[model samples]
Target: MEEIYAKFVSQKISKTRWRPVPSGSLQPAETFATGSWDNEENRVLLWSTGDLGNLDSDGGFEGDHQLLCGIRHHGDVMDLQFFDQERIVAASSTGCVTVFLHHPNNQTLSVSQQWTTAHFHTGPGSPSCSTAPCTGVVCNSPEIVTVGEDGRINLFRVDHKEAVRTIGLVTECHSTVWIDIPTSSTL
Candidate 1:
């Protein structure tokens, strides 16, 4: 027989991803991350499913998924992706992108970098700007790509505070992918 477990988190979950287990390791995935949306205050949270292989007196899994750590998010968590074992990248509805670093030793999460108002819209003759929702994000080690409702795509390097490049005027850019060519160009 197979077993299943569930938890009732107060906020609606928008996205979730399992932490990648190191290669050649004997353990199953024990950690995961979650992003919440439509709440008074949004957040990115880490959870741990303790000892799946351990059985209780009743022959059930040992413990439920326990909260490891969490941090407040500026807007609705539009998308979430694990940049690496210790880093998490989140896109926001406020047109901001943030990278969070997880400290396993202390069980803490901290803001590593952030790009505020990375996406926005401006009318042809208007001097004011409106922020657009960043709908999606993808990561390739130190490089991250974000797409927004403003039809803009931005490429960022984790160590830099500013965007490396921006591709504007795309139509409904909800997601993106990196393509490497033989000639040393990425599309």
Candidate 2:
């Protein structure tokens, strides 16, 4: 077993996802993206974790272990996952889910898509069902699944950010998965 540790910031970390390498790339899979939370401003960053334990305690890595790119987010990031090698999906506290694309040649990251008001919590006194926080999201190519604190789970397709299906009236749901609930039609 091997342990690798890299330090980037003091803010609370929300998620980290490694970039997937294609079959015939000359470069190995060494780049990763990270999301941070609980600070005055939230941020997402791309970093390269070079050799383990290469820093000399001066907050600097001797080699390529460093931050590559960063972007400011509207709110704290709750969760993040890679939609593909070049893209990432992030769930935010502002009730938004955003998609980002990474360009290696120019080393840039850009928001490619977003679903505003995907999930939200209107505080303790909102009668609307839309007042629930989004908890998690999962991507399976043509499908993207999301769960919310209001006990709602939504399914979306890649081409459309809007949900194709929504399961509501759920409460305090933190996470969810896609499962085959038997239908009478199948019987």
Candidate 3:
């Protein structure tokens, strides 16, 4: 039989990703990340489903998912992706991108790097700058790519504070972005 568990978080969840497990490892994925949207205060959170091996009399796992740690996020959390086992990358509606580091020793999350105003829009004859919402983010370890409502794509390195490259799609806007990594070469 299958089992299902649900939790009522006050805010609407925007994204969720399971922490990647290493190959040849006997351990299963016990943790995941979550991002929230349309709330007074948005957040990026880590949760643990507890030990799945510990089953109760009904053959269901004991306990619900527990919040491990969380951090406040600027604007709505538009997109979220796990960079690796210990790092999470998040794109926000405020046109900013952030990388959060998870410390297992303390069970805490912290901002490791951020790019402010990574995407923006300017109106004709308007002196003020408006921030564009970063709609999606994808990660390939050190490289992260983000797409925004302003029809712009930005490529960033996790260790750097500035974007490595930017591509503007003048006539189009995007809501999601993805990455494809080549595993082998064809002769």
Tens digit of lDDT per residue, candidate 2, span 1-187? 8965556487688888777667567776788888988888788888886665576668755664578887777677877877778888787777778888888788788887888777765545775545345667777676777776656677777678587888765655455433332242154
CA displacement after TM-score superposition, residue 38 of candidate 3 (Å): 0.8
Query: In candidate 2, which residue ranges exceed 4 Å CA deviation?
Result: 1-3, 23-28, 51-61, 121-131, 171-187
The alpha-carbon deviation from the true structure for residue 174 of candidate 3, after best TM-score superposition, in angstroms, is: 3.3
Tens digit of lDDT per residue, candidate 1, span 41-132? 99999999997768789986787688999999999998898888999999998899999999999999999999998888888863488888
lDDT of the candidates, in the order given: 0.86, 0.73, 0.86
**Lowest summed lDDT over 10 consecutive residues: which window, candidate 1?**
177-186
What is the overall TM-score of model 1 with all chains considered together? 0.86
Predictions ranked by TM-score, top down? Answer: 3, 1, 2
Question: Residue pairs in steric clash, candidate 2?
Answer: 120-132, 151-170
The most accurate candidate by TM-score is 3
Clashing pairs in 1: none
Encode model 3's per-residue lDDT on 16-89: one tens digit a residue.
98887775677768899999999999999999988655778988677568899999999999889889899999
| Candidate 1 local lDDT, residue 106 | 93
Which regions in candidate 1 have their CA more than 4 angstroms from the true location? 53-60, 125-127, 172-187
